[model samples]
Target: MRERPKIKDIAERAGVSVATVSRALSDSALVTAETRQRILDLARELNYRPNVSARSLRTRRSMSVLLVVRDVGNPFYLDILKGVEATAREAGYSVLMGNTESDPARETEYFNMLRDGHADGMILMTGKLPPAGGWSHLPVVVALEMIEGAGLPHVQVDNIGAAREAVEHLISIGHRRIAHISGPLPELMSLHRREGYREAMRNAGLDVPESYEVRGNYLLESGQECCRKLFTLPEPPTALFVANDEMAYGAAYELRRMGHDVPGDVSVVGFDDLYLSKAFYPPLTTVSQPRAEIGHVAMELLLKILSGAEIDCDEPIILPTVLHIRGSTAPPRQ
Candidate 1:
């Protein structure tokens, strides 16, 4: 019977140490790309297969990562999930998804998975942390949203800056009366975006009335509800800056139902430009978040953490955002 190829065989044929072969196979960054490629090519030629189960037993690692998100159904997170899954697969790790829907018990269960070593680490997108187990000494990466004072590695876009830019766009188009539809306040993202909205309005020498800001649960229905309350006001806004594209879509739908023309009766701006934003009736004007990139980076950061490597930078990795000015926005009607 022929013998199965082993790491030792690859190392011997490639003239590299067994440790180098191991590191390269594990996708360790310590190995140079050239060396890793060479090792991989040799491994393929030799028909070498990794014994992940044996390795996991030796390292006492589950060989898996946990990705917990607030809402699995929201397309806002679809690309992020893809990024994480792809990166994990490349690094020879499996990803387990937890859809918490911002539920306390569900979140705690996922946290327990990490604490109990069912997974090596976690990438947390839910705004709140575990209520009981706590996050101390846990390997966690915050993605899409930052949990202030958690002091963990985070990957996200500058919500305040992005929101400010979206709002400012409305102002630039001669919108004097602009309202904001924000997401839930508990999430730092929602607050930061609202802060940006106020900042832009303040900078433009405009007043933000208490009624001008309405909070939603980052859902389509809530956005529709916000529009209902806003449009009834004695002085309804000529434009709106919604915290997310889902809510923005809802606002646009409701406005049309209410007999208002998008960008004709009311201009709209949205954040987290979801995929469908561009294809909508009047293509949405929105802030485009690097969803897939954020996920990919967050997973990479987690992999580094698991590898016991010191991250090059201790600060949160902030990705850039772009504003897509499309058919949804124009100068407010006279």
Candidate 2:
């Protein structure tokens, strides 16, 4: 049998210490760039491959991270996942994704994977944590949503302020009877957005009747159903602030089916300016959350935690959001 090349052979051929070869292969900044390149060339020439399992055993790390998302079908997660994967690859780490569909059992299964050393850390996009609390010992960073009192690090946008801004825009455009299609209240981000909507209505001296607020699952069908119910009201709203772009599309479709013209009889605003938002009829007016940036920062935070770096747990990283004005919004029809 032919013998496999080893790091020792590469180091000897490059006339560098074994530690230099190791550090260079690991992309360590401690090694000079010139020396690192020379060692890397020698390693390539020798076809020496490090044993990942042995390295993991030595370092007690799997060099892989897990990302838990509630719904993989949502386009909202695409950009975020791109950021996570890019950052992980640059750091010589791999990412494993789990779609829980908001199921507790699925969440628990992924948590067990982390505990069993399948991953070095986790970035949670599901909004909800595992029911069993023992996973707190693992390096975890919550992304896009916050779990109140969890004391876990997180990266998210100002849902409240963004919602308020969206609603305020509706109010400014003479939308006295404004309605909100909100996400499920179980998630803190949804709750915060609803509060912002209420705050905006109150500030504008507009009364938000019970009929004006409807719960949605952040899906198109939910938006369509909710919009239908709202339209049946004796006094329907002239504007809607939907929790997401998918729902906004649904609401618009339903409104048109009911013989109303967008921004002509009704105006619509949505959250998360998804890619399709721009291509939608009359282009959606929505809040732009930096999805990729949120993912990048969240993964970076988890990496820091795994490295035993001190972070300000007292402060959660809050990214800003922008309210985009588009053709979908205009003054309420006289």
Candidate 3:
């Protein structure tokens, strides 16, 4: 028995053309103040509110931002999401979270949603960006771990430098036999961090032996398994440089279970200082990244692009990392 009023209804009531009503509602300069006021009054009298979806189609924007990540459960991503959420909200925009779980198919699905105009902009913080042939059509902003050739704006920490810093810190503490627990192959972020480890080893004139490094899946179990393998080495490393804090925790736990004293028998350093790192029994010494700031800046850049402002797509804002010295690291046992 009732129908929702359309722009046409407002136009009819305001004694103005549909185009004038549209311009007035959008606050375009084409509509005079008198006409805008008249339309506004009529619209309020009719209890009219502009249809967001319909207006989005007309303006080619949804006023929404998409945050694509691998695993939302990981606490590392939470800070970034919070930053994005706060900044986006302040800018009068909403955010949509997308979990791709490092799956190419799911990443493509989210991209499709953005391409179809479900979101005005996107910040990809996961490893799920389409490999190739998926760069042609993209959202207004793309922020993720470095993609080989994907031409999208992003903000990232210097993974290589940060990893190297952690390893080097151990080296400086007299750890000549430093081992590395790396993530799976082809994970750009992991690979970058691994490279940093390698660079540190080389600079120290130490041979990065095959036995001294192990490939991990960036999981707790992987760390435990790799630790066991490392322990069996004829010349076990005195210190281990783990890829992430989560894996480091597991490795250290396993080492203690195996009757090895951490920082006494085997020192360990980790990356991406997670919240639990500090509260653990011996407080993990790891690299502290500005997680929230990265997300905040990425969203800020996307908002600029959405507002039709020019942006330097090639420029990368790499934030610095801090090495928080804790009890997990010490001079290799003499």
Best by TM-score: 1
lDDT of 1 by residue, 263-291 (tens): 89999999888889989979999999888
Window of ten residues with lowest summed lDDT in model 2: 22-31
How high is each candidate's TM-score? 0.94, 0.87, 0.82
Candidate 3 per-residue C-alpha lDDT over 244-322 given as tens digits, one digit per residue, 9 for 90 to 100:
8888998999999999998888888888889999998688999898999988888878866665555676787788889
Clash pairs, model 3 backbone: none
lDDT tens per residue, model 2, 27-80 = 565778799788877776776767777889888889899989988888899899
Question: Could you tell me which residue pairs clash in candidate 2?
Answer: none
In angstroms, the error of model 2 at 234 is: 0.8
Q: How many angstroms is residue 107 displaced in model 3 relative to the true structure, after the best TM-score fit? A: 1.6
Model 2's number of clashes is: 0
Model 2's alpha-carbon lDDT is 0.88
The per-model lDDT (C-alpha) reads 0.90, 0.88, 0.82
Q: Report the Cα lDDT for candidate 1.
A: 0.90
Q: For every candidate structure, what is the RMSD over all alpha carbons to the true structure, in angstroms?
A: 2.0, 4.0, 6.7
Stretches of candidate 2 above 4 Å error? 1-51
Worst-scoring 10-residue span by lDDT in model 3: 135-144
